[model samples]
Target chain A: MKILVTCKRVLDPYVKARVKADGTGVNLDNVKMAMNPFDEIAIEEAIRMREAGKADEIVAVSIGAAKTEETLRTALAMGADRAVHVVTEDDIEPLGVAKVLKSLVESEQPGLVIMGKQAIDGDSNQAGQMLAALLGWAQGTNVSNVELDGDTANITREIDGGLERLALKMPCVLTSDLRLNEPRYASLPNIMKAKKKPMDKKPIDELGVDTAPRQTLVSVSEPPPRAAGVKVASVDELVDKLKNEAQVI
Target chain B: MSILIIAEHDNAEIKGATLNTLTAAAKMGDSVDILIAGSGCSGAAEAAAALPGVRSVKLADSAEYANQLAENVAPLLVQLAGDYSHLVAPATTNGKNLMPRVAALLDVMAISDISDVVDADTFERPIYAGNVLSVIKSNDATKVITVRTTKFAAAEAAGGSASIDSIDGSGDTGLATFEGQDLTQSDRPELTSAKVVVSGGRGMQNGDNFAMLDELAGKLNAAVGASRAAVDAGFVPNDYQVGQTGKVVAPDLYIAIGISGAIQHLAGMKDSKTIVAINNDEEAPIFQVADYGLVMDLFDAVPQFTAALD
Candidate 1:
């Protein structure tokens, strides 16, 4: 059984984001980008599954602009056998991106696929499910744990309150949430070897997948800033204010 | 163009997130049609029918919709999607799971977690846990979108006497079968639904100390929450993490216990109605925006406060 891991390059989580002055978009003039955190977990899991002898080979795939190859290399340094880069300069809508991946899956026919549950950037948490749905495969999302049996894979997901355990048939898709596993950094030796690893590009056009976008963006605006609150003297004053002024009670 | 807002729900009740999606749909276009595709969920349809701004409510109740399985909802939406130019769902777990399939089935790209609509075919979404925002334009004819509900207000419960309409089930129940469901019980309103919430952080020490937050929650009738630090430290589970990474909640009252109010943590709960802080550190950032402040140890103040409530 082979595993395909999906990842993306997004803005680094530590950088503070600022809206553009003209309000056209984010001010990315100097913002640095890195591999998405959850996708890091996805890469690590696929490599672990392969090393554990649970899978035959592990392949890493990334979708984004040219610099996103940096992210695939990051995945390779973490030990994926090969890489598939679906090159698109524009940050295409996730559904289009998923369609490109569905075509990749049809070509690869991997027994299992894993991806980060949500990209830290959009926080949409939809691509993995969309990919599974397009492929007509069983799926589990926000997964913290996964166990593969003969023809089925068991997934432990982080739901709203507690965890839900699901047993999915083989050729399934899984998206990772936090606590799934701590992603390991690429060792110096592996980082050096990753340079030589096969990094193949699949121009989305060659995939024969329709990348047509459906949604139209009307306006992009910043969320209203939180108003500074009035500080109360004591709990008594708070309760009184709640009852008399706020009328929450 | 008309917008189709897909409502997310179990047979029991519609999630508050669905109402927020309606709030977003109202911003997008004049006409709105909601699809409540779940099994025997007349309750859900009734709720959708009552939404003040909606023109039509489409109910596709079926036993197979018990899971609201993506396979089923995808084809149904695809079949029903032609009439409307846009299709949308709340970016909840169910919506995230369902709409991608519909987008794929339609052979069009779908946008996820749209915070603001840029144009009819463009949007701005945050990346890196809201640390960065990206504005992009879509070239698709009829866009599919999933929205983060925290940004929108819940639709008012105005009496609108709406029409109750039905559509045939998309019934493409593929191979997956219904396994049993495990529901978690809590007395307080859900985080997304609660008007108030009190959350703990690593400063609270351990899981047992969570009781202090719970007690305060009960007093406030608020949901219980925890910081990602608390969850990462194993003091609590991931459900409690309130940051760019976890659930986003905007409640009427918010109390932070022993939390320093990291920017990431603030991103999750900052939209709350009123903020309160109970931390030992006098300079904790949580106090900076708190509506009420207790510059004392949470361990000591929590018990005293709970006692005061009792």
Candidate 2:
């Protein structure tokens, strides 16, 4: 069985994101970009599955502009057998991305589709579940653990209260959550080898999916700032303020 | 416009988050009908029908939906999607799991975890860990949305009478089977709905030290939470994690003990009404958002604060 893992090039998680002056979206000028951390976990999980003899190959896919190839290369360095880049300059929504992934799933015929639960940039946890719906496949979102048995994937998901287990049949979709696994760093030798790995680029339009935006961005702005606070010298003073000044206690 | 809210519930009772989602729906006009799909969930349906502003409750009782699998629930939602102009759910783990599937089946893009409903179509949502708030307008005929329950006040649970209608269930797809669940059974208030929240971070040292926070929580009738650093340090379970990746919480009073508020951690609790930060490091980012800051050792301050609460 082959594993198809999806990735995205997002603003590096550590960087402080600033809004554009015009409030249309985030300012991406001269900022560092990296594969989404959750997607990195997805790629790592796929590689582990192959290493455990559960999967034959790992094909990493990323959708965005030319810079996305760098993210695909990182996945290759991490252990994906090959990479596919869907090139598009347009800002696509999750539904559009899911449609495109559906097209790829039809052609790739991978036994499983794995990706991040949500992108750090949009913080919208939709694509993997949407893709599963489009393909009429079983889905396990926010998955923290996975175990393969015959033709089933036993998944442990991090839910609101605690963990819930489910057994999903093969040809399914799984989204990686934070507790799944600690991602591995690519070694220098592996980074050099990644440049030699095969990578295919396909223009987004060629996939024949309606990659159109259904939502209009009205504006973007910083959240309302909280009122300034004062420091309390002692626990007694803090208790006094909570009981009297703030009236919260 | 008619709205269909998918209620999140176990077989016995509806979750509190659904009441918050109901408030969001009520804000967008009042043709709201809640769908309760669970095995032997008439109790949940009755509870939904009693919510203030709910027009009715549609119950789909079936064994296939006992576990609330996205595969089974999404199909049932799609089957009933034609009558409603909007499909809404609370942005809990269950809502986040299933709403997108319903949206995809309807071929409409969804707005997830909206903090503000500007109008029927426009909403304000946080991106970049709440650093940037984006306002959006959807053009879809049937809008799909997941409400950030913490941002909305929960509707009154009683005082309204609405009709209950039994709906047919879409048979299971045989794609997934329920195995088991390990739920944290706690006697304390739930973190999301608690009036007060007291959270710890790595500076707490270890899991054993969390007992101090628990004691403080018990004093104030609060819920205990932990920053991602604390959970990553194995000081607490993942469910105790409070962050952008974990749980979003907005309570009346939020106390942070020994927490150096990272951006992601702040995202979860910054919406709180009154924040109190107790840390030896005066420069901890948690203090920036805190309404009250105390620069002291948590080991010394926690017990004193707990004692002073009375």
Candidate 3:
């Protein structure tokens, strides 16, 4: 069975992203870019399944500018067998991305698709679920644990209140959450080997999916900063301040 | 324009998050109708009908909706999409799971976790862990949205009487089956709605150390929570997590113990009326937000503070 994993290039999670002065989007110039953290987990999960003999091939797909090939290389280094790059410069929304992935799914016909629950940059958390809907397949979002049975995937999902276990038939979509796995670092030798992996680049227009933005980003602004606070000298002072000044105790 | 608010309930009663979503919907327009889709959930429909500003309650009762699965609920919303100009729900797990699928079927974009309603078309949402806010405008004729409940106060549950109308829903999708769920049965107040919240971080070391937080929470009648690091370390379940990706909580009082206050965790509780941080690291970002900061070893300070209260 073949597994399809979706990877995205995002601003490093550790870096504080600033909105552009023009209010269009976050300033990405000179910002360090890396494969999305959750997508790393998805790639790691796919590699694990492949090692366990459940998957025969793993394909990593990414949609972004030409620079996204670097992200695909990272996935290749992490153990994906091949890479597919859908090159586009537009800021595609969740629905548009899902449509593109749906096109890929129809063509690839992979037994399973794995992706991140949400990108740290957009935080939409929509693409995987929307793709599943488009494909008329089962989906497990925010999946913390996954066990592949004969023809079904038993997935443990982290929801708002607790954990839910679901059995999704084959040809399903699984979105990885933070606790899914600890992503492995690419070794120096593997990073060198990833350069030789076959990577196919395709134009987004070829997918025949509408990539227009359904919503317009009007402006971006900083949130109201919390006022500067005081450090108490002792626990007694803290309790006294809480009781007398803040009145929250 | 009329708005359709999807009610989040448990068949017995409506969750507080739904009421908050109703509050957000009422801001968009005056005529707000709530859709209660669940098996044997008339009690929840009654609760929904009583919420202030709700014009009517639409009930879709069936076994297909017993679990409120997205496959079942999204199609029903799509089918019922003709009457309303806007579809809204709380940005809970169920809403996040269901609304995008509805938006996809309706061929529209779903605006997620909107914190403010600039107008019927425009909304304000947080990005970059709430450090930055983006104002977005939807061009779609029928708008789909999920309200961030923490940003909106819950609507009053009493004083209004709305008529209940039954609506038909689609049958089972049959793509997936719910095996079971393991919900943490706790008597303490829910983390999101608690008046006071006490959260521990990775410094808690192990799951057993969370009992110290539970004890302190008991004294203050507070809810116990954990930072994402603590949750990832297996000190507690994911439900106890207070962060951007986890539960967004804005209590009256928030106490952070040994939490270094990553931006993600701060996004969840920074809106609290008062914040108290106790950590050994004086330079922790949590201290910057703490109204009362105490730099000390949590293992030593927490027990002493509890004893002092006793």
Candidate 4:
């Protein structure tokens, strides 16, 4: 069966994000971008499923501007058979992105769809569940472990208290969580071979989905700063301050 | 506007986070109803009915909802969608799993993890791991939202008693079946609800080093937590993770050892009342938010701190 994984290009988590002076959005100019950490885990899980003979072909998909192709190539180097890039310059929201993914799912007919639980940038945590609802399919969000049976996938998800396991039937959606797996780095040879992999690019309009955003961003501002306090000379001094000054202990 | 809150429960009892969500929902106006969807959750319904500001409780009892599977719960919520103008829940794992599905089925955008309710249609949410706050205005007729419970105080669990009404369930979708669960059985308080939390980070190095944190946590009667870096490094289970994508905790006293405090990790705990940082690196971001900073190796500082508490 074919497995489809959705990858997103996001500002590197290591970089300090700055809100634009105009308060429209985050400043992305000259910021290094990489595949979202969660999406990287999704791609890694898909490749592992294929290696285990649970999947026949792995198709990696991404939606973004031209720079997203680099993320798709990274997926290829990590072992995706091919890739499809939905080219768009517009800043699509989670619902819009889900609609596009739904259209792709209809056309591709992949048995399973795996993607990140949320993008590090927007942190909406909505697209995968929205796509599952649009398709009227079973979904396991924040999945940490996945075991494939004959026609069902047993997914263990990280929950508030602990882990919950569910057996989702084929043609379901699964979102990767932090504990899913340790993502493997792309070796130099694999990176070289990824250039020769097939990459198909399509305009966002071609998907035939209404990509309009329902919510308007009024402003973006820096979070209230917490004033740095003084460093204690000794542990005894820290305990004294906690007891007397801060009174928290 | 009438709001329908999806209560997070485990069949037996209601979660405190649900009460916090009620606090947020009550701010959106009056006539708030809590919906309890679980197998044999009458007790949870009773708990919901006792919450202050809740006008009523809707109970959907069915075997299909035993696990609160989104496939079944979303359809049930969509069926009951017409009565309420807003659907809200605490931004817990269950809420995050279920709300988007309900929103998608209802054809509305779900505003997630909102920290503030700006009027009825506008909301404030954090993005970029809480580095930036974005104010959003939703045009959807029916707004779907998940509240960051840490941002609001939990509504009183007992006071005004609301009537409980049983609601019919939407039949199971049969798309997914619950296998089982592996909940971390701990004597310590839950991370989200704990008054004091002791967290470790990548500096812990390995799983074995977490024992030191457990020792300190045990002494302080604190819940143990870990940064995303510690969880990613296999130093702890995912449940111990406290971050933007993990559990958002706002304990009264938070102690961080060996944590560099990435923005994501800080987002989960920055709301903490008094943060204490113990790290060898003075430049660690954890120090910025800490009320008390101790620049020392965790291996030496943790033992001394724990002993000092004794």
Candidate lDDT values, in order: 0.79, 0.92, 0.91, 0.92
lDDT of 2 at A54: 96
True contacts kept of each: 0.44, 0.93, 0.76, 0.86
Q: What is the lDDT of residue A53 in candidate 2?
A: 95
**TM-score (C-alpha) between model 1 and the true structure:** 0.87
The segments of candidate 2 whose C-alpha lies over 4 angstroms from its true place after superposition are none
Error of 3 at B297 (Å): 1.1
User: Across residues B81-138, which tens digit of lDDT does each residue of candidate 1 receive?
Assistant: 8999889998776777777778777877777777777556667776545644567677
Task: Give the Å shift of residue A9 in candidate 2.
Answer: 0.8
Q: Score every model by TM-score.
A: 0.87, 0.98, 0.99, 0.97
Q: What is the TM-score of chain B alone in each candidate?
A: 0.88, 0.98, 0.98, 0.97
Roughly what TM-score does model 3 have, to 2 decimal places?
0.99
Which 10 residues in a row give candidate 2 chain B its minimum summed lDDT?
Answer: B21-30
Which regions of candidate 4 fall more than 4 Å away from where they truly are?
none
In candidate 4, list every pair of residues with a backbone clash. Answer: none
Residue by residue across A1-249, what tens digits does model 1's lDDT show?
889998888767767567688866566677898888898998888878888889988889988778878998999999898899988777666777787888888889899899998776666677887788778887788888888788877777776767667667778888998888889989999999999999999887788876765555443456656566666556666667766776665
lDDT of 2 at B167: 89
2 or 3, which is superior by DockQ?
2
Off by over 4 Å in 3: none
